[model samples]
Target: MAPGGPELLLIVGIAVLLFGAQKIPALARSIGESAGQFKKGQAQVEQELEEIKPDASGAGSAGAGTDAETDLES
Candidate 1:
């Protein structure tokens, strides 16, 4: 009834009883590591997108079409 589910609360209570005061720092360290990894991955993805961005002169065509094709004999 606490919104997370009875099984989750039971597990959390068991963990607290077992670890007491010694596990809080370790859990926080693990959460920090996860957050740092997520941010690093997000930054790398954004950098890659910026690198592939096209210019305003239309020279960065990504295989859509070429303007010189209309004058060819084909």
Candidate 2:
């Protein structure tokens, strides 16, 4: 679950007290940039998984269990 409004305000107030008003903006900006980078990396990994999904899900996979299937047949 996410934090409530009061909790959020309290966190922000604590941050302001700890970092001061001027530094808060810079800190927030850096946090946003880091989150964006994280999202981009996540998207790239998801894309790679999608690209590999078809290969694993029946595409060119028929031959993969050929030996196992033959062993079972015997």
Candidate 3:
């Protein structure tokens, strides 16, 4: 469920009281920066996963050389 107007206002008021007016802007800025970094990291991980997905699906079809190689090594 989502918060209503009153609940949001109450939370904002509490934050203001806890952090003070002067610090609020700085806190907001830091929170925004952190969110941006989190999103960037999430995108990077998704891209890497996409890059590996095709290779993973084709691995089995690449043939039995892998097994033969392992046997030779032993």
Residue 68 C-alpha lDDT in model 3: 84
Tens digits of per-residue lDDT for model 3, 1-74: 98899999999999999999999999999999999999999999999999999899787756677888889999
TM-scores of the candidates are 0.49, 0.71, 0.77
User: Which whole-number lDDT from 0 to 100 does residue 3 have in model 3?
Assistant: 89
What tens digits encode model 1's per-residue C-alpha lDDT throughout 1-74? 55468888888788788878689679879999999999999999998877766553356463335545654646
User: Can you write out model 2's per-residue Cα lDDT over 1-74, one digit (the tens) per residue?
Assistant: 89899999999999999999999989999999999999999999999999989878875667768977999999
| Model 3 misplacement above 4 A | 61-74
Highest TM-score against the true fold, candidate: 3
Alpha-carbon lDDT, every model: 0.76, 0.93, 0.93
Considering summed lDDT, which 10 consecutive residues are worst modelled in model 2? 55-64
* Candidate 3 residue pairs in backbone clash: none
- Relative to the true structure, candidate 1 reaches a TM of 0.49
Best by lDDT: 3
Model 2, C-alpha of 34: deviation from truth (Å): 0.6
lDDT of 2 at 4: 100
- The TM-score-based order of candidates, best leading, equals 3, 2, 1
> Mind sharing the TM-score for model 2?
0.71
